[model samples]
Target: MKLGVVGLGSMGYGIAASLLRAGHEVCGADVNCEAVERLRTEGAMSEEIVTAAPDLHALVIVVLNSAQTESVLFSENGLAPKLTPGAVVICCVTVPPDFARAMAARCGAFGVHFLDAPISGGSVKAAQGKLSIMASGTAQAFEAARPMLDATAETVFKLGDSAGTGSAMKAVNQMLAGTHIAAMAEAITFGMTQGISPDTFLQVIPDCAGTSWMLENRAPHVVAGDYTPHSAVDIWPKDLGIVLDAARASKFSAPLTATALQQFIAASGMGLGREDDAAVTKVYARNAGLTLPGEE
Candidate 1:
């Protein structure tokens, strides 16, 4: 298969490398010239993505949000017009289901298969090609995307026979994920107020019922005082915004998710927007006037 991956951030870069290793001819592009050159050295084709359109069997868009995803496919230099009729587009952004449905319809006009495929398991898993993919699309879209999915995913969940469902499920997952991160911050900080160290919280929490993938993955960054952004505080605002918007449309009450969204917002407002999301703990620490470890 010939594949083109746009947006070579941590996740996109890994997905492109995985495709390249799976014997697919991969063309990778990004605004980051350094990343493109690096991947080029790793056997990725150096052509600008637009130039590789007609040759690509699958075009994976792992950008940040719905607008960027739409821009990549429909912008002035967009690939849709240049794509071969049966080519598939696997959209892996966190977006609303209605947006996914709309994109699918538009892609249908050009005979391009659009799969609403949002991914999980973060950058490390992405590098190992073991991410979990929540995917939904028309049968033709699935058939066209299967090879690429097989190359990148450890678990490819077929959510439905249309594009929106995958986005719907992704919204659900983000609600829980965003909430978990905020909850972890709250719990860890609360433990500190009672004289428990972040290290102690981490050691005991994983075996408790409160443990979650997000907590185990993120809490260590707090304990080590490594605020480097594997996933930034800004990401949750976008992801959880998608969740709340979806919930609003469906009249679903997501009070817990709503509260969690506020903490990330506060963290970003405090100029911590680009920090690792575990930095949400700062919101809790500031409130209680408790200094977290590694902080002055």
Candidate 2:
């Protein structure tokens, strides 16, 4: 398959690499010249995606938000108009359901099939070609995107045959994901206040019923004092914001999601936005006047 991947960030770069490994002809584009160059060295090409747009069977868009996704597909120099009919667009960003529907409608007008596909499983799984994709779209869209999906995902849940269903599922996942991370941060720091070191918490908690997947995954980052981002602190504000937006539209109250959003917001406001989301523990640490592993 001939594919184009826009946004060579952590997740995007991994998806492109996986596609290349699967013996596809892959082209990558990113605002980050260094990331683009790195992909080029790995047998991915960067020769003007627009020129190859018509020939591409799939374009996997892994940009950050709905706005960037829209700009990449429909704005000046966007590729939607250039792509040949029957081409599939695999949109892997976290976005609202309504936004996904709008993109699907727009792509339909151009004779392109849009997959409302949002991915999970973090950078490690992304690099391993083991990510989970929550996807919904027309049967034609599924048929068009199957090769790329096979290359990039270990688990592809066919949630529905429509645009918004996939995004709605992703929003539900993000609500749980974000809340779990925040809860892990809270618990780890509360342990510190009780004279339990992080190492002790890690060593013992995984054996306990209180342990969660997020705790197991993120607690090690705290133990090592590494704030390097697998998922950055800034992402929650966007994802949880999407959840809250949808909640408001449905007239549903979500106090827990709202609370989790505030903790992430506080983490970002404390200049940790670009750091790993595990830094949400820093908010708890600051409040209790205790230090994490690497701090003085």
Candidate 3:
């Protein structure tokens, strides 16, 4: 299949690389020219994407949010006008269900299949093709995107054959994912006040049920004191913001998710927004006057 992947941020870059490695004819675009050039060096041809857009079997959009996704698919230089009839559009942005439904309907009018496919397992898993994909769409969408899914995911849960369910499930996952990350930050720093070092906590916590998928994955970055972002601190504010927005739309009271959003907000206020999401712990660390690993 000829594949065009848009957005080469941490997650999107990994997805595009995984597709290339899977032997697809892939073209990549990113606002970061360096990322696009890197993909060019990896055997994806820039000339091919534009000239071949009409024959492209699938277009995988792994952008940060819905706006970017829409821009790539339907904006001025949008690929929707160029994509072949019956081609599939795979969306990997974290977005509201209504937005997902709207995108699906718009694509349907173009004789294109749209998949509401938001991803999980972060960048590491994305690079390794071990990420989990929560996906939903028409039967045609899934069929068209199957090869890409098989190449890029360890597990693909078909949540429903409609636009909204995948985004809904992604919202549920983000609610838990954001909450777990915040809880991990809190517990690790609280342990520090009691004399348990971040290193020691990393050594002990994974074996306990108090641990979570996020803790097991992100805690090591805290212990290593490497805040170089695999997932940036600012992503949570957007993702949890999506969760809270959807919650508001549904009149749902999500107290835990709300609290987690505040902690991430505090982390951003501390100027850690550009750092790794694990740096949320630093908010707690600073509040208690505690030193973390690699601190002065």
Candidate 4:
């Protein structure tokens, strides 16, 4: 398959690598020249996406949000018009369902297939070609994207035969994931106030009924004092904001989601937006005047 990945961030780079390993002809593009060069060294094509657009069988978008995704596909010099008529645009960004539907419609007008395919399982899983994709699209779009999907995803949930369902499902996922990470931060820091060290909390939580995938995955970062972002703090404010917006549109009550969004916003306000999301623990730490593991 001839594929192009438009964002070379952690998750995007991983997806590009997985496609290359699957023996696809993969070209990568990013605003970060270094990320493009890094993937080039790993057997991705060095050609810019514009140059490669005509021959691309599928273009996978792993950009940050709806706006970037829109710009990538439909901006003045967007790739959608440059693509071959039958080429598939596989959108892996978390976005509002309406945005996904609109993008799908626009792509259809260009005779391009649009797959509203939002992904999960993070960078490690993406690099291993083990990502879980929540995908919704026409059968033709799915067929057009199958080779790329086979290379990049371990599980593809065919959510519906339209564009919005996949993004809607991704919203549900982000609501829970962001909330869980916040809950994990709160619990770990709350334990610190009780003299239960972060280390001790990590040691016991996974074996307890209250533990979650977020706790097991993120608590270790807090314990090690490593804020290096596999997923950054800034992601939550946007993703959870999408969740809350969708919830409000449906008149849904989401008190916990609202609370979690505020904590992440506070974490961002404290200049922790670029840090590992586990660093939300720092917000609690500051509120309680408790020093975390690596703080002086």
Clashes of 3: 0
lDDT of 2: 0.95
The estimated TM-scores of all candidates read 0.98, 0.99, 0.97, 0.99
**Model 4: lowest-lDDT 10 consecutive positions:** 287-296
Off by over 4 Å in 4: none
Better of 1 and 2 by TM-score: 2
Greater lDDT among 1 and 4 belongs to 4
What tens digits encode model 1's per-residue C-alpha lDDT throughout 74-185? 9998898899999999999889999999999998899899999999988888998999999999889999998889989999999999989999999889888899999999
Residue 87, model 4: Cα distance from true site in angstroms: 0.7
CA RMSD of each candidate after superposition: 0.9, 0.7, 1.2, 0.7
* Candidate 1 wrong stretches, greater than 4 Å: none
For model 2, the superposed segments whose C-alpha errors exceed 4 Å read none
lDDT of each: 0.92, 0.95, 0.90, 0.94
Rank order by lDDT, top first?
A: 2, 4, 1, 3
- lDDT tens digits, residues 7-113, model 3? 88889888988998899988888889999999899888776455677978999888888888888888888898899989999999999899999999998889999
